[model samples]
Target: MSRWPNLKQLHYLVALAECENFNRAAKACFVSQSTLSTGIQNLEELLGVQLIERDNKSFIMTPIGLEVVQRARQLLSETKDLLEMTASRGGSLSGPLRLGCIPTIAPFLLSPLVTLCGETYPDLDLLLREDTSDNLLKLLEAGELDLLLLALPYDLGSFHSRVVGQDPFRLVLHEKLIDSYEANPARYAGLPDHSLFLLEREHCLTDHALSACQLADQAKINPFAATSLYTLVQMVSHQQGATFLPEMALRAGILERTELVAVAPQGQMPHRDIGLVWRPSSCRVEAFAGLGRLVTSCLR
Candidate 1:
């Protein structure tokens, strides 16, 4: 018979990897430091590999330790899903569901989504996290997040996703700028060069906007990038430059206090698809789909 590391040992490894301190990891796992340390030793002994590099002074996770932590996370997530699957087999989706959303969409959708989820699934505990798309996706992949609600056309990378709604991009600019463009439409010609302000490139919203609006020329983009939609709005409010804002934000009254104008582009309306994404191994696909339908309703 072959020996294998137990779930408890793996959990300790993950906690240790994250905490980087034995005392902290032990506290996180609700065990004594010696107990957690022994469990890690046992795991390494069973596997016949040094998972952590140790010294008299300090310690660091070996390269293999980091890789093991990643796998341990996945295994733990799978085990959790398996238990949840069994528990939810004969009942409604009822558990703590950790959901992640990108920053741009979170402000506009989180309130309504929470309200709707509370009304629809009273038994379900919906946890929310808002971060950049890249960060959220990383969390989701690590099993720290159960699902994601974000703008689509993102590379989900083996995750299953369903586009639930379309969030069209509207050209937003100062009232004076739009008035000038309207007065001389030919001179403006869609978007003038050196006039489009965008969120920093780290945000997927920036890429989505650029792709949707076909703004490929670097000359069209202002060198001064914004860190958030609020910053972008503030920049445009000061007559800095034009920008593309999602319609949901406009509907949520992002421009209520300001005198900015949000209008459709000249030809077809450019848009980003709003989607729900989850790991393929998730057992709550139908529940997520139902949630997706609710999201679509909120879009209306």
Candidate 2:
């Protein structure tokens, strides 16, 4: 049987691959640069292959090195999982769990969910990342995150998802603009092209809001696009334009001081389904399901 490098050396390799600089990698690994270099060199000797191509100016991973680093990451993750499993067997559920959430849902949903998680699973080490849907999915695919909480009709063919609940949208109009919307409903049907303020293009919430409200042929929207639900509320409070928000957010005190009127859509309520997503190959499926249950319980 061939010998193998130690886990310490594998850690150094993964750090180097991520940082691409010996000094930075060493810092990340909490070791001196020389120590990191020596460890990598020893690893190379044991593996009988050069993993990195480096000079004073730059560091590049050899093809073999890239493969090694990828496998090293997986190995480390599995090692962590094994340890977590041992802890679980010992009647504990303590380990770091990286979770990603989208902007629209994060503000309103996370507070209650986090509280519930702390109360129910105090041993879980939760690390939260708030980002856009696109960015969160990328992180989930790359193994940087253990799971994701986001809204659907999102296309996630590569990931496994479970619908947790639905959050319906509410039309938020400036109090002063309410009369205009009430008196002239027909004129405002296409108001997205005229007076509506929407989340920036590419935000899934934007599409959810627009489609749910059936504003596809609306008038020209405001030139300024809000980056977040809070920003949209702020703009609607201060400006004459109207926006859409999820009911949970509005009920969560997002409209405390704002002169905004919440209106139901004319037909069936417009809403988006929220879901918990994880990679199909993830080992933490049970823990993620527990988290989903907690979220569903708290949100309801």
Candidate 3:
């Protein structure tokens, strides 16, 4: 039977893999460079394999070392979960909670929530990453994030979610376009394709906006697309284009300086569900629930 590597050694290996520099890895692990090196050497001896190749200029992990590093990350994640569970059992709310937030939601939602969390749970450690919904979900599935704050309507078949609130979409237009539209709303009915600015493809919000606005004719779609809400706002502010924004974002002062006019649709307001999502099998479900409640409270 092969002997197992100690958790300390596995931690060092993971840190080295991440940093790719012994000195930096040692600093990350809060250990002396010599101690870190000796630990890796002991780990290699115990496993009977050379895990890393080191020279003057660079450090390289062998193929086997790469595989080991992958496994080491999983082990560390499991270890963290175990420790969190233990702490929870002891009635303590302390440890690292990795969270992912979609770009559209993060700017408007997280600032106040972060302040609230800091005041409420001083012991809780939060590690935040911002990305698109698709990317965030991929990270959640890979165990890289414990929870995700996503603007919903995209399919989430295997995950559990708690809806915190709804954020309605408001029509955004350049000041000139607003005056034109107000003077004669029918002029916008046959507007040119380039007059409408939208988020780039692959974002769920783009689809939601299109569907909600009944913009099914592909020929009337905008040629210019933006990757972020901020970019879309910028395009609308500078160029003679119009777009849509979430109500919460407008309320959060997204258009404070811009000469952008926000208007609700005549009929049903277009909106998206904002929620907290987590893997159904997560042991940190309670923590996620707590976070959801806090978020709901703050939003209210």
Candidate 4:
């Protein structure tokens, strides 16, 4: 018998802890339920610890199990980093590279970035995930995502980041509203309550826009929120409310078929900085740097 629990057993334990169901955990680990159960049992016997309390329908991890799971996650992340460092010694970026992006930027940059990566690094298999910044960052920390392309000035904690470009904000409103504002310039500040719409609070873009465009008052007016940029645009088209759109969205022709107008906000225009971020321990810094240049060119 080995003196320490093997990595495979640690992996199973972590997967079970995360999925909370033996069947689902087994599926996630790409193993049969019986195999997964036996592996956990063997791990328990080897460690001489009761990791979980099993019931007919569900199971609960013991307190020690929870602590072990946390340690296991860190161990797994470091192990992956070690493997990556070993592979990168050849000085080539290949194999599966999982990348995550925020919802606001994904539609505009994902396709072009994919095309560029395919052309430039044919050996690299780029796997993309579009999610909220918070969720993507969580995935990055968990080692589920290799890198992230998200708006900057965010709290990235200890992760390293590089700015790629600036995405300026534009005030998007109904053409009629634009005309009304032009006719009555004083109405700009007094724009009707609930006349400003933005994404749900979970999206960092909402905070970014509010801070950058100084639309804090406008946000106070509306209890309503849109789930996506497309929904926000539709709401504006229906004369519901105005929104602050990133320059990349406008360049992508998001408002092309609508009567909506996108114009620079009054005073100096504010913008979000686009950036790429990764764990400092990652060995793919060069690859990420090259990707930053690609994203910059795409923004151009």
Q: What is the lDDT of residue 189 in candidate 2?
A: 61
lDDT of 3 by residue, 157-248 (tens): 79898888887888788777766656655445645567778898777788777767555556545788999888999988898678878877
Q: Among all windows of ten consecutive residues in candidate 1, which has the lowest summed lDDT?
A: 183-192
The models' CA-based lDDT, in order, is 0.85, 0.81, 0.80, 0.85
Kindly report which residue pairs in candidate 1 clash with one another.
Answer: none
As for candidate 4, its clashing pairs are none
Error of 2 at 224 (Å): 2.1
Error of 3 at 47 (Å): 1.9
Badly placed stretches (over 4 Å) of model 4 are 183-187
* Candidate 1 residue lDDT tens string, 194-233: 7878899888998888788766567767888899898899
Give the number of colliding residue pairs in candidate 4. 0
Better of 3 and 4 by lDDT: 4
Ranking by lDDT: 4, 1, 2, 3
Candidate 2: residue 254 Cα off by (Å): 1.3
Q: Deviation in angstroms for 45 in model 3?
A: 2.0
